[model samples]
Target: MPGKFVVSITCAKDDTDKATVGFVVANAAAASDKDTVVFLSTEGTRLSQKGYADDIHEEGFAPLGELMASFAEAGGVIYVCSPCFKKRGLDEDNLVSGAKVVGGAKLVEFMSDGVSSVSY
Candidate 1:
């Protein structure tokens, strides 16, 4: 793809709004046909675990879990920070759809091609 987009989210239940809207924007990026990635770091790594986002439903928006699923269905990639995941003791076996645990180098590599990025 000619265009690449990155959405960097560092909060999860600690900030439901950011977590939810991040994926909302990710869905938009995916629909726009950009090579989109939602990088979950810090507290956001918890979201990579199955059922972690199931209960997060922001006001006037779809549930976080559904938003995430649809984002993956739209071909969006979800990158969970390896250090953060291990720091939180999150289970790799329970990773949600489209979610992959990766190191900082991976994120840097993806964005090395002059990609656009947003943070929350």
Candidate 2:
């Protein structure tokens, strides 16, 4: 039983609370020694950009940027939606340290083997 956790977030600053909580869950999963991946799509693709998460802070939670950093530091993977990123004209060079733009198939492959996933 491989403990793989997938947190799929479809909102970014547009829905700070959801995005913030998503990263929070990712952090927890990573800390618990689970293989964790955060799949960012739609507006959430913006979070893959360095500094885009910097100003997001939901009440009663750590700052969004800090949560994202912690999750990465804890060995969490961040998969950004390729098409969504390109649609917004985002620069690949500006991706955050642990984020990579990928097609949906990448995510499908990760979950194909069985995973626990939650969406925000």
Candidate 3:
């Protein structure tokens, strides 16, 4: 079975640096053959919107949108927190590629097997 890795991001436009780096790490894990997941919560759920990341470009890194797209293209999963997303009134129809709206139980289930995780 493949090794599992999780990058839990809790901020988006509010903290673009963290969001960018989280996706960067997620991409690395995915490229290294790990089953990578990026859990978006709090303000981070905004990133699931199709055009939300379009203008965020951290210095010395690819644009935020590109990083997210690359991570998904590399087979990484993006888990958007259901409560947080709903609380923010984010558009479900505008969800980006590879993003799934899920509850905490889903997160727990995925990580129950001792999957390694990081938070941003």
Per-model TM-score on C-alpha atoms = 0.97, 0.96, 0.97
Residue 99 in model 1: lDDT: 95
Best by lDDT, which number? 3
lDDT of 1 by residue, 34-87 (tens): 999999999999999999898899999999999999999988999999999999
lDDT of 3 by residue, 64-119 (tens): 99999999899888999999999999998999999999999999998999999999
- Candidate 1 stretches with Cα past 4 Å from truth are none
Q: What is the C-alpha lDDT profile of model 2 across 1-120, one tens digit per residue?
A: 348999999999789999999999999889889999999999999999999988998999999999999999988999999999999999999998789899999999999987999999
Worst 10 residues of 2 by lDDT: 1-10
> What C-alpha lDDT does candidate 2 achieve relative to the native structure?
0.93
lDDT for model 3 comes to: 0.95
Model 1 — which ten-residue stretch has the worst lDDT?
Answer: 1-10
lDDT of model 2, residue 4: 92
Residue 37 miss distance in model 2 (angstroms): 0.3
Error (Å) of candidate 2 at residue 101 is 0.7
User: Could you tell me the TM-score of candidate 3?
Assistant: 0.97
What candidate 2 gets wrong by more than 4 Å, as runs, is: none
